[model samples]
Every structure is written in C-alpha cells, then in structure tokens.
Target: MRTIEVFADVLCPFTHVGLRTLVDRRGRYGLTEPRLRIRAWPLELINDGPLDPHHIAAEIAALRGSVRPDLFAGFSVDAFPGTSMAAFALTAAADRTGDPALVEDVGMALRNAVFEEGLDIGRPEIVEPIAVRFGLEPLDVEATSAAVRADWEEGRTRGVIGSPHFFAEDGSGWFCPSLAISRDDVGNFVVAWKHGTEAFIDRVFG
Candidate 1:
C-alpha cells in the first residue's frame, strides 16, 4: 500500500477538476478504499482585500471556459462566491472531525454552492447551511474556522505553492490532475508487480 498525500485549496476550480477526476478514477487508481490521504492546504484567492464580485464572476467564467466548459457552460458565475473563506473553513472542519471524508464532502458542497447554486461562501451564515447538510455539529464549524486560519498561516510557512499538489511515498510529486498517470498505466504497473519480474523492474525503474 502506498500513501499519496494530496494538497489542495478549495477555492481553486482546478482543484475541483482534479478532485472530480480522481473520484472518477478511484477504483482504477487503486483508491477503492481509504488509502489516499488528502491534506487540505488553504490558499487565498484575493490577496489585498475583498475581491470584487464582478471580477470573481469573470474569473470563474474564464476558468469554466478553459477547463470544464461543458459543466460550467450557461452557468452563472455571479451565483458562486469566491473560494478563500470556504477553503479555510474546510481545513477547520477536517481538523475537528478526524474524518477526511467530511472534508471532501464539504469541499464538493462548497464548490457546488458557488458554481452550481451561486451562493456567497465568504459569509459564515451562508456556509452554515452547507455544514448542516453534511450533518456536522455547530462546534465543528467553529473549530473548522479556527483550524483553517491556523492552517493557512502554517501552509504559507511550509512553502505551499498552490493547490492540487500531490506527493507520493517514493518522493515523486505532481502539481495537477493532468500530471497523474492514466488508468492503463496504473493497471500495467499492478500487473507487472503481480506477474512479471522483468516487467516490474522495467515499469518501476525504466
């Protein structure tokens, strides 16, 4: 069993795309169980101050157009809020729950809240309902808030460059889902490991 550490920021559409792709390839990627360990790294979408709603909408539109045009097509960017607060909140939630699945769920819900429902995620009041939807306790939300803030500060100190960063046990790193090997590649590796000694050597070393 290999441990894969996933670093992601909730505010990033690329993160969302990466997660969706991973979910779609779970079994194929040998993640059928709880083998993958995801670590949320909060990132700031707006640096100086509050982001303009219009600008956020435009960025969302551009991101959708470039990456997931079909899912975001005809979708109103104005409805979705920016990612900063939500990402932090999720980090907080993960800290308290001890259940990483909760983090994944909340992250997905947060993205849907913005991209699909067009809700403002920056406000705590708006995010509360999403938390409830996940059956999280009120204290959990509060704890998540604190955790996210601390994590954000810590992430900066750790030199976290961006979201969707992946680290493998072998010291290999990947920055995006696009960098992930194909399902066939994973399968071949598994097959070589199980059956062919030379094939396994070639696959792993070459």
Candidate 2:
C-alpha cells in the first residue's frame, strides 16, 4: 500500500480543483481500494488580515469554464467564513478522529459549505452540522479545533508553505498543483493496487 499525503488548504481554488480531479479519477486510476490513502496537510490560504469570502468566491467562479470548472462554479464563496479559520477547523477535525478520510471529507464539506451552499465554515456552530453529516461526533469539535492549531505549526516546520502539495511514499513531493508525474519516472512503483493494476501500469508506465 502507498499513501499520498496531500498538503492542501481548503480555501485554495487549486486545491479544490486538484481534489475534484483526483476524486473523479480515483476509480480510473486504480485507487478505489484500501491500498491508497489520502492524507491532508493543512496550509493557510490567507494571512495578515481577514479574507473576504466574496472576493474568493468570485475567483472560484472565474475558474469555472476551465477543465472541470463546474466542480466549483455553482458555489457561493461569499457565504462562507474566512479562509484561515476554515483551514484551522479542518486540521482540528483531522486530529480528533485520526481518520484521513474523515479529514478529507471535512475539507470537502467545508469547501462546499462555503462555495456551493453559501454557508460559513469558520463558525464552529456552522461547521458542526457538516461534520455530523460525515458521521463525526459533534462533541469532537473542540479537539478538531485544537488539532488545527497544532497542524499549522507542524506544517510550517515541514517547509510546507503552500497548498496542493503532494508527498508520495517514496519521498517524492510536489508543491505545485500543476505538476504532472510521468509514469516512466516511477514505473516500477505502484501507483495504485487493485484489480486493474496491470492495466493501469501498462497505460501509465508502458
């Protein structure tokens, strides 16, 4: 089994796009089974001052019409809360449960709440319902919040200063969302493990 550590900020449009792309291709990429893990590494989208949700939403809207634009176009960014706080919240969520999938779900839900449903994720009360929807216990909110703060500090120590960073099991990492890995470079390495491993390897590494 190989794990892909995805260091991303929920407030980042590129992270949203990259995640949607990965989710869309998960099965096609032969990562639909237990052999793959998607871990989150928190990153801050805004600094110094409060982020305007409306402006962020508009930027997300502009990203629509590009490849997979519909993945985020219909959302209203203005309805969501600030970016920095949301990132903190997600980190807290991941820490409380120790479930990477839950962390990813929380991140996705936060994005949807802010961009698609025009909800405020920065508010603990607002984010609680979404967390419940993912089967997380509402009481865990406090733990999740604390985790966010700790993760932020850890992220900085790791030199992760941006969103959509990829850390592969082989120690290969990518900081840019636009990075594309050639199969030949790590052909013998397992990209995914499933019934279609042979075919996936052939298509990617052949």
The model with the greatest TM-score is 2
Residue 115's lDDT in candidate 2: 58
Residue-wise C-alpha lDDT for candidate 1, range 1-206, written one tens digit per residue = 33455667655555666566555555455554333445656555326454455654554454554445544433355554544565456445654666656656666667666656656676768877876777764444566556665655655555556777755566555566342222244332111112332332222223
The true-versus-predicted C-alpha distance at residue 205 of model 2, in Å, is 11
lDDT of 2 at 84: 45
TM-score of 1: 0.63
Q: Cα lDDT for residue 195, model 1?
A: 30
Task: Assess candidate 1 and give its lDDT.
Answer: 0.54
lDDT agreement of model 2 with the native: 0.54
Model 1 misplaced regions, further than 4 Å: 1-4, 27-31, 34-42, 52-63, 73-75, 138-146, 169-171, 177-206
